[model samples]
Target: MAGLVWKDIIYIKKMWKTMLFAVLFFILFSFSRNDAVSSMALIAIMVGSNFSMIPFNYDNYSKWNEYQYAFPISRKTAVCSRYLFGVIVFGCCALIYALIMMFQLFIINEIPEKEDLLLQIGVVCFVPVMQSILFPLIYHCGVEQARLYFVAIFALIAMLVIGCSSVIVNMFCEENTIMIIAAMIIIPILLYIFSLRLSINIEQKKMA
Candidate 1:
């Protein structure tokens, strides 16, 4: 599993510079527009959630899926490694985004709004939640087919988050914000676990 995870890390190493450049460019753009928080949150979501998708394309192009069975690895290990890789990517993206946002806030000598903070917290978990739905589809179908579903679903989710973030935050009181954030984190984790199991099953059954 670690080897598989390391393989993905190595595969994506070249992407780090490009992703970082895109992130810094957007951060400056958002700050200039005076909509840094929301824009950064969206950027984090867009980048973090889709980090593994390109690697999937690479895998397909290299016929890694077909060649994987040539190794002695189990299907469960392979699926689990993908999920683990996703967690590492999402966690790092979220952390880096938060740190950069804090630095930006410090530069402006401004504090983040409570609603914005809560919304940002929710959005942080949103990547894994979406991935939980996406991974099983990729395992059952192929990455190409999964990408089609992912685009539609991702668009809908991004719209909903943007449209309703403020309203939902304002609708709830401070105390309820804790519960909301808790749900945001917990639900995704549960969904991720379930998705991991489902992907393992799909892989196990695929060439059995």
Candidate 2:
């Protein structure tokens, strides 16, 4: 499993420049001055999370999936590794966004309101939901096929988030921040568990 995760990391390293460019582009686009903080954060999280799929794309391009079966690893391990890889990538993106938010508040003298913070948290929590849908698609359909639908899926999610962020925050936020935070933690774990199971089954079928 560690080797599988490391393999994806190595692929990311090889394409570091492309990843950097994409990140920069997202950051710039998110900071386009017309968007709200929550919208910007959501876009950043989406873009960042999507980067994890690059490894799968590379795998397809190089026929690594076929080659992977030559090793001792099981399809379940391969699927779980991708999920873990996504979690790590998403975590890094979240951390970077947090740091940037802090820098904006402390250095730039721009403080975000409580509502803004809550909305950002809400947006971040939604990332795993997107991943839960996407990973199984990649596993079953192959990355190339999945990539086409990826655009549509992301656009739909972006529309929902951007269009209904206020309503979502209102429904989830209320007066207690703890409840929303708990949902953020719990919901993603549940979704990821389901996603892992689905991906494992799909990979097993592919292997068979």
Candidate 3:
């Protein structure tokens, strides 16, 4: 299981130079904005969302799945490794954002609002939440088609949120805040577990 996870890590290691440039660009761009802290928070979420799905593309390009079954690893381990990889990617991106945030807050003496702090927290969890939505689709549909479906689903959700923005705010008022937070926490865990199981099942039946 560790080896499987390490393999994906190796793939990420190869992209470090490119990712470093992207990080620097995002930081610099954020600093140039009027709302630097908010920009930084959104930059973090963008980075997490974009990079967490790279391994799927890498695996498909290399035909890793077809070859991986020759080894002794179970489908569960393989799927779990991808999920673990997403977490690692999320951690690294969140760390970069945190460091930048700290430097801005303490070093540069920039202060952020409470909402910005909440945004930072959301940035930290964005990738895992995205992975929970995407893994099952990718596992069942393949990377290329999955991207389309993912975008479509994301667009639909975005439109709904925009259309009901006022309602959503009212739904998460002081009285319902705890319930909303609990649902946010619980839904992702349930979805991730379901995605993992569904991915493993799909893998098991892929070439059976």
Kindly report which residue stretches of model 1 are placed more than 4 angstroms away from their true locations once superposed: 34-37, 172-175
Instruction: State the lDDT of candidate 3 residue by residue for 78-146, as single tens digits.
Output: 888888887787778768878877987899898865444544554455556777778888889889998
For all candidates in order, the CA lDDT equals 0.79, 0.77, 0.72
- lDDT, candidate 1, 8-111, per-residue tens: 98888868798778677756766776655567667776677678676677788999988897899988888888999999978887877687667758876777
Kindly list the per-residue Cα lDDT of model 2 for residues 1-208, writing each as its tens digit: 9998998889889988877887677666666666566557666666765677888888888888777778888888888888889887878677767876887788878887777777777666667777888888888787878878878878777777778867866775476788778888799889999989998887788655
- Residue 69, model 3: lDDT of 76
Q: Which stretches of candidate 2 lie over 4 Å from their true place?
A: 172-175
* Minimal lDDT window, size 10, model 3: 168-177
Best by TM-score: 1
Residue pairs in clash, model 2: none
* Candidate 2 vs 3: which has more TM-score: 2
Cα RMSD, model 2: 1.9
Residue pairs in clash, model 1: none
